[model samples]
Target: MTSLPKTMHAVAATGSVPLDDERALLDVELPLPELRPRDVLVEVAAVSVNPVDVKTRGRRAADAPPFVLGYDAAGTVVAVGSEVSLFAPGDEVFHAGVITRQGTNAEFHAVDERLVGRKPSTLSMAEAAAMPLTTITAWESLFDRFGLRADSTGTLLALAGAGGVGSILTQLARQLTGVTVITTASRPETQDWSRRMGAHHVVDHHGDLAASVLELAPGGVDRVFTPSTTGRVPLFAEIVRPFGSIVAIDEDPDMDLRVLKGKSIAWLWESMFTRGVYETPDMVGQHDLLNAAADLFDDGTLVTTLTHEISGLDAAGLREAHAIVASGRSIGKVVVAR
Candidate 1:
């Protein structure tokens, strides 16, 4: 094992005490891990702020110091465990870690080799930082949960297409196969960007979402991806072909699911942590899926959707990131440099 660094820095929310001031992220020195055989320690280069981090901060009533929150990391490996053979000390890599552990806001992080993938050679660390969490979500929803054939020629309806996961999914569906991809974005800029990202058609998500989608894909879509919190997007079953699939990442259960019984729609809820949480048989799917994404990136088939960049992993910067996302209309991903 490599000698553990004596001290490292991370943006932390200290104390369980609740106050408006608690939102300020503080720099704190933390001890790096004593490496294990199968683990690799990465020197984080860039990180992205997701909605999960904001939710985590608000949930803590106390000054809960030491809560280092971040999920997505694009960085370079600096040390490896004895059993690790996939990467050496100089490889660039990325991964979105489980929700339970300390996150990627730190200058350094340790991850199991099984959970990480080589960064896309086509992208910089900032661009690669935007891919993992959202891409993992999109990949798992489209491929794993829906079981859509890699070569499926069906139409896919992406709800809130301008958001993080939807932006990536829209392009992935476009670049990977012959799927007729349609996405919803309310703003003018978002609509244009979604089209640029390869959505065959773009519609307003504000009005009756199903009706707007029906306008472009009147023939009926084969897949529905609920990437954002759209209570109405679940009605996509109405626009989807009978027996078509609905893959949802929305945690909110406000939809009238009772309407789907007649269509016999295949509804699936995708969570990237299912395998790591349950130790499922195909837990390594994340590793494989990310590698597949890297390949598409390298081949020029896929594009990076990094729209916004912020500096430092501090609470102020995180607040801005969350505000943009909470407004329900951000195109692509927002990254924060270490």
Candidate 2:
């Protein structure tokens, strides 16, 4: 009989360096994980690359020891921990992992059953790998931050960038809410992609974003959404109508907040990792939300946002995937197969 192939392929950094530097990421072997008491072992068939993965690998430190890098995965389970009852060995699952430890950039990875969701039956592994992170961010931002009712028809203005999360956000807001969507993209390619994802209107984020928006919304947009850095925060004061809200997942840059003082507008931040990192009481909300997204996808109310496919589960493949994101040219998620 033939023996099984070794379950040891992994991607990692060999030394501290910038991602643009040559030899920044390297291939290596890692001992396959021994399932923890509450872990479910996933035989990674396909994994997707996100900006977070690139950020973690390029800038995160691991002392002298090497650390594995990856965040989103779609695969089948091969084993389960003693306490895991939600999954079986044959179950196909998907998850975007917690950032405190090593992630899914390997042949096999173990995750707590609480964080993993059954893969949407209607989507392929390459497509399914794109949902978790961006979905959570957009969902939480829509409901938690802007207070945009799922059934509201008020206008939403997405300022700056039209990549993965923005693409998914446009679709969900259009389908699930009473929101008229306008998105900002600096380039023609991004503008076209946003429109394809269902943005009702597209404008350039460069030049005068606020003036451009006001021209359309003399009364101002009901809400403003930003997926890019906080440097653009001040623009919200002029574009959002009085009492409207601005929601962001990007850094809170040094900008004057006094611009919105007269309007009573509020600013909100969405960080998807907050619950898992703090072990919040509602930590399981992530699992529930992702499962809901899966159901929506299977039932045909939603769609996956995969933009590119990079073959191989090795470092070179992963590096190429990372470069796509780092280049700021990626339209959506980039997936790699095992």
| Best candidate according to TM-score | 2
Tell me the TM-score of model 2: 0.92
TM-score of each: 0.90, 0.92
Per-model lDDT: 0.79, 0.81
Measured with C-alpha atoms, the lDDT of residue 129 in candidate 1 is 91
Worst 10 residues of 2 by lDDT: 1-10
Query: Where does candidate 1 have its weakest 10-residue lDDT segment?
Result: 15-24
Model 1 stretches with alpha carbons more than 4 Å out: 1-4, 14-24, 63-65, 254-256
Residue lDDT tens for model 1, 1-338: 46657778887865533324644566678888567686788899988877666667667756455678888899999989999988899899988877776788888888777678899998999999998988988887877777666588978888878888888888878876678898888889989988988899988867776777677777678888875645654466578888888887765666677677788887789877676667577766777888888998889878888889988666666656766765555678889875
lDDT tens digits by residue: candidate 2, 1-338: 23334567888765567666545777778777877776888888888888877766766554646788777899998888998888988899998877875788888888777778889999998899888888888888987777667678878987643687888888889888878899988778888888888888898877687788888788999888776755665667777889998887776657777888889998787888888777788877888888989999999888888879888888778878888888977787789887
Tell me the TM-score of model 1: 0.90
Error of 2 at 213 (Å): 1.0
Q: Evaluate candidate 1 by giving its C-alpha RMSD to the native, one decimal.
A: 2.5
